[model samples]
Target chain A: PDPDAAAVQAAMARNGQLTKPPGALGRLEDLAIWMAGWQGTDRPHVDAPQVIVFAGNHGVTARGVSAFPAAVTEQMVLNFRAGGAAINQLARCFGARMDVHALSLELPTADFTIQPAMTEAELLEALQTGWDAVDPASDLLVTGEMGIGNTTSAAALAHAICGGVPADWVGRGTGVDDAGLALKAQVVAEGVALHAQARADGIEALRCLGGRELAAMAGAILRARHLRIPVLLDGFICTAAAASLDAAKPGALDHCLAAHVSAESGHAPLLAHLGKAPILSLGLRLGEGSGAALAIGVIKGAVACHSGMATFAEAGVSEG
Target chain B: PDPDAAAVQAAMARNGQLTKPPGALGRLEDLAIWMAGWQGTDRPHVDAPQVIVFAGNHGVTARGVSAFPAAVTEQMVLNFRAGGAAINQLARCFGARMDVHALSLELPTADFTIQPAMTEAELLEALQTGWDAVDPASDLLVTGEMGIGNTTSAAALAHAICGGVPADWVGRGTGVDDAGLALKAQVVAEGVALHAQARADGIEALRCLGGRELAAMAGAILRARHLRIPVLLDGFICTAAAASLDAAKPGALDHCLAAHVSAESGHAPLLAHLGKAPILSLGLRLGEGSGAALAIGVIKGAVACHSGMATFAEAGVSEG
Candidate 1:
């Protein structure tokens, strides 16, 4: 059975049964129902949606593509662990759990104790780490990343996968100006050219060119899909990891649903390539699963629509 | 004391203090916090949010200005009362109360079996009905309308209040084409000319040309302000009623919050006249408090930002 196909069809059917006009809730209606199908039930509910925020030190941060200093990556990860960031506040609002992991990829030692970057030989161990971290009963997994200038890594990964011009995929990272973006694009183009042979190595290509958290997220998604767990993906950065993972295994996206269509221009194109529909388009550019946490309610709403709505037959109302 | 001004300022201040970047949440940030200040508390929540739907028979509907028949207004109200309409489903989702009123000035009946429409003599009663219907302890009032050619009524009312040319305020209502809109503008212009003398009588101008709900909602807002209740307003039709009330009593809009910036071209000008910011900019042309219901979450989010977020001092984080 094509679980993804069956799941998607089930989602659409749930949306059709909602009390509002068909498609009245727009992208939100689609997302909630899609999540319902992925959970394989009409009464889809998210209890303690966990946000796994993985922070990696990207070699690309050496180049000045982002507004913040590269040191901010580990710093923000600590802030996340301490529950002092925007995403942490959002998680508290949604009553979701937050897990912070520092993946020591480029700089083997950060001030904080870091998880191993995990060499090719240790990939199995890393995968097991991911598996043990997630609850099998989780309704959803939301993976986010913290690495200064990670957008540059994301763009490079997108370039390697799509074979599209790197300049087209690049954008202002963390409120960079036009000139900064131009520099960012030039850096991505050079990085893609530099990493061309590595991308040819598949997952190894990802390890060499992608951020540590992104790769870990890829591993997490693979494990989630294997365990039949569903994932809610955030903006462009997370989408990049999902795309790279999908390239490794053709249907990896089968377990994934998009949370928001970001204002970042690259996000829409990347989501389009992945063939995923985003739930909200509020011009949100914040990372760290902010979109995903907010969207948990929408999925809940969809479940409510399917289960809570008294059908026309039940409400004793004539259907036109 | 300008209660409205104080409320507006408190809202702005509370929003600025929210956890996100100063203006990152955009219009939504403003809406939720504004509501908190209006409610005179930090933890602003909507319990029993009521949507007062006003239905009227418009002469413009007689001129074929709308796609649906004017008879649909009464039919939809009955549908609403029967809990078989789009608004019914939304009200159910939001846990809001729905009240439909038929204006005696435009409807076939004046008895109390259904809601009574008011004449000038019963203005105080109409105002009190709006005030009493809103629960004293409730957090918000959501307003919507259902007159087939209501856009024509809205445009004319808008023209009377703000003095925009009829063409500027006229637009497609329920999929009317360019030609249909042009005809609508001409009809509105004629109506405006015919009612020019009533301009001296602010409420009279509204009564002679406005929809039943428009007048009642005007009374609603005026009463809501005196009662210190907050009103969450819907699209163009409701906005026109709001503008009319604001023009009559300068502080009437103080207790009201615009729920959306509709695709209706007239809405922006009317909003500018009212000097209020709408919470959402979804291109919703439907005027059933649907946009308002969606925006409620945003308001809640803002309130959370104000009441739930720790100050820089409280969080003990460096904010330099």
Candidate 2:
């Protein structure tokens, strides 16, 4: 709860100075202030928005949780390299740089061994790689993910943390139908069972069964805080990553902003756990931080409200 | 449906040539194609977006249908003049210019007469004012609204045009209470009863009991079409305006795009009556074109999708 109410109050007071009316920017005003606190400044900027796409092979792909094949992950990584994926589009949208770090939590990469999440050193090494990607002077970090059947992984991570039923959490990952959803629930249940014997703690649970990308994202969020960078969490799996980080570092939620509540059922639980509210919800199930990028407008509006709005005194307008 | 299938198909083909992936721009892609047909260009721009804000006084305001005083309608117009209103903020978001015109259909402005919807000459004059404001060279026109207790007027219009119970269409307006909503419903029922005289057509019914602003907006939408300008309809009241226009001229919907749905119950009926699918729905009940302006981002995305995405030929990328 280190929201820095004084800083928030100061930001609210400063909002009247902007060209617009008081509180007209809505949730964006809150985002700018939260960003202000994260940056410990009255002015915040995305000087360096380090975007990472955490990829993993979902066990639910075996059960058909996606319209695309499990191989789309590898193919999309090549697409990312070719600047053909939605994430590549978004990277251009924010003028942000993206890194596609292949995690060996599931399938071993071309040169790396398939590392068990249970191994503390391996988890640390994966996280360190993610942390090392972000520059020390970066102002903000945004994490996005790409994976077929990733919702199953998200549901499993949420189930592990919230002790919720897998059925209540599983949803249409990339437009899965009823039978596909049922199959997804079965696979998530299996993953939960397989990882149940691992360390019951936050980082340990992630190390045991979480995707390399998710674990790395968790590490990145934590490191962002350590580096004084604001981290904007994108969509469901990203929220799961935030939850893992929150579980590891009790106050990591302080540095995290929930970008949007994905239509995914698992998203609500993670947002609730983190005590964060999404900026918008337009039935967007598209990953690649599309919802998050759309939310930047609100953030900009909030900043404008704080920086450009005219206070009653400034406008010489009568008050209630 | 004169939806130029070949043109739309060609537009879809051209979308991938812009810079992003195919369909990465989502709804914005649709907007671009729609604009291409309306503006008859592959490169469409909202260089002069004609936004008309229609204000009218609602009879349901006496029933406590709103949070602010019904007089706030007039006050909000002044607020619009002072640029202290939400719609003004929204208009700024899109860098779109707006004109707030008071129709004689509502309560009389301090300087004008309260012309009911039945007066064709007065109604035509207001519509002309809205039309005159639009540049003939404009790519698009957006119709927005501001009226206190106007929801009651809109519900009545929806019922008259779309055919629905006043109760089903009634809800909290401007922060009304349970009793206020009940009273608003009673008033709406009365208004509908009094205005039930219809000639089996939308234009006739609207003229009999519609607010001045609603009728003017309806006129603006129609005029925009005659001028080949596509209309972007805002929330509840604006939808009512569009329905009126649709009733006046069949296929009016062809010239229109529903910007966003409102939380207000009347919106669905209006949307249904006009046969439109809204682009966004964020529980927006405030009607100063904030939702429309918010949708501007989506529109920009759409235009960007159509204009910026790289074609397969250019990218040398393989498709599924």
Candidate 3:
């Protein structure tokens, strides 16, 4: 469903009357209005935001594509559950409710360099898990991932959907050295080439190249879109997850925000290709939705000011 | 006093042990270390951040240099005190203690195009007012201002200290039209020309070209520097105020962070000149320390992740 047009118009009208000069709030004004339309309220606010971290193990980890071993993905899920990860701290700091989902960690996805990463049934189940995980009461959503070799899968997804070579989409995921970077790029090239159907179908790309957690994030984002909940897309891997949706159907990400460009080099070109401008350029490379979670504070301030501030008339201040 | 170096090293060592990959947290890591050094704690947090807003009237408003009337300054000050302004909401949102001080509102600063904006006594008093307003107990500080036509004052100050021509420093402050922008550029050029001594002396620039509120911000920033309280420079005007301190002495803003570059065109060049990279480029042009206040969330998230997250040893997760 499209955002309510009347609420957006009303938000714009109210923003103009705010004490500050028109457009002085810059992208914040646009963000507030965007939220207003989605929430169907001229006064937009996000009191119950949700941060979900999906964890999956990748068979590509056996290829020396990642610095961390595959078991770390499951261990990090436990860390998240124990509230000891970076995402937990960030979510708590921003007053967000956080959840972690570990998907078939014992059964890693197939190595995409050799064949498809997931069967259609596996992809559908992962997407269903993501869709069912979203809490309907959430006014805002952020989907993040924890996977050992997911960046390889993400790079392959980008290479497939955006028609890029491996190097353009690959980056040093989780502090891999130069040789690992080169090897990951080569793996991405091979995986993307082997899955030619992915280039023609965004959903096909998910089955052929993306990991389970990445598929879950895409499903969660799609659920948010259907529910008219505003979404803040995290760094590179998460962006690629959402990009698959946009590729399958253009404007699928219209309800989502490219929260920040990560330290990953591929994120910038991917954002450009999707025509989304990230609000933050922080050098964050963490993928537990940490960057997007931190940005929750920014969005809160925007809505707080939008709803709480006095208008020119109410303040009895002269307007320009 | 400089930041505590020992604490900084301790924070860096702690950051390396966090569960996430090294440098994965990006500039958040640096911000945490910066806060740690200033607060003299390995676990840095901004529990009692202070936001001070100084309001004054600019005599240059008589020259049609602003879209807002001079009377709007006092009115906006009332709005701030009434907790009805954008800054009030933002400060509240970030859990910062908000204080507003009206500095000789009845006595507008002299128009710098004709003569120095303030006499030696007036500049000293404004500086003293700013210095005294800061609470020593607060760990973080952000100084903002409300004054009609102060952008003209700020642009003039930047021109004097940074050696830029008027056009290089002037911008559409408070939504001025093309003609108003041209007039502001002319005003800045004339002000810089009339007060040539300001070009050589940063303090002289404040006395000759800066408004009372701007000088107050400079003084407050200096106080934070002395107390080793970390500061977040707001938008163009606030950055200009802090630049005055840096001009008087190299590394004057060493304890400060350039929070964001504003919509004002001069801000980018000014930040570049100072060799400070802003964490945000949100196109926010609203004064009253709004931009920096919005950034408190980012800083808080950084420190929270730095201080609260468990190490790989504690979480029992494999390290990269």
Name the top DockQ candidate: 3
Which predicted model would earn the best lDDT?
A: 3
**What TM-score number comes out for model 2?**
0.78
Model 1: how far is B64 from its true place, Å? 6.6
Q: Name the lDDT value of residue B236 in candidate 3.
A: 90
Candidate 3 clashes between residue pairs 3 or more apart in a chain or in different chains: none
State the lDDT of candidate 1 residue by residue for A186-297, as single tens digits: 8777766766665654465465556667777777777777666678888888898888877776777888888777766798889988898786666666677767666665
Q: For candidate 2, lDDT tens digit of each residue in A1-320?
A: 35456666777566545433244344556667887776666655554565677665644455555666666676666666777555565555545677786665356321111223336766677688777767677666777767666677777777787777888778776666789888778766777776775436777667765666676777777777777777777888778767877777677777777767777777877788778877665555656666666665555444443444445565543442
Ranking by DockQ: 3, 1, 2
Tens digit of per-residue lDDT, candidate 3, span B1-320: 88899999999999999999999999999999999999999999989999999998888898999988899999999999899999999999989999999999999999888888999999999999999999999989999999989999999999999985899999999889899999999988888888886788899999999989999999999999889899999999999988999999989999889989999989999999899999888999998999999999999999999999999999999886
How many residue pairs clash in each candidate at the backbone level? 1, 24, 0
Let me know the DockQ for model 1: 0.20
Model 3 spans > 4 angstroms off: none
What value does the lDDT take at residue A152 in candidate 3? Answer: 90
Report lDDT per candidate.
0.66, 0.65, 0.92
Choose 1 or 3, whichever is better by lDDT. Answer: 3
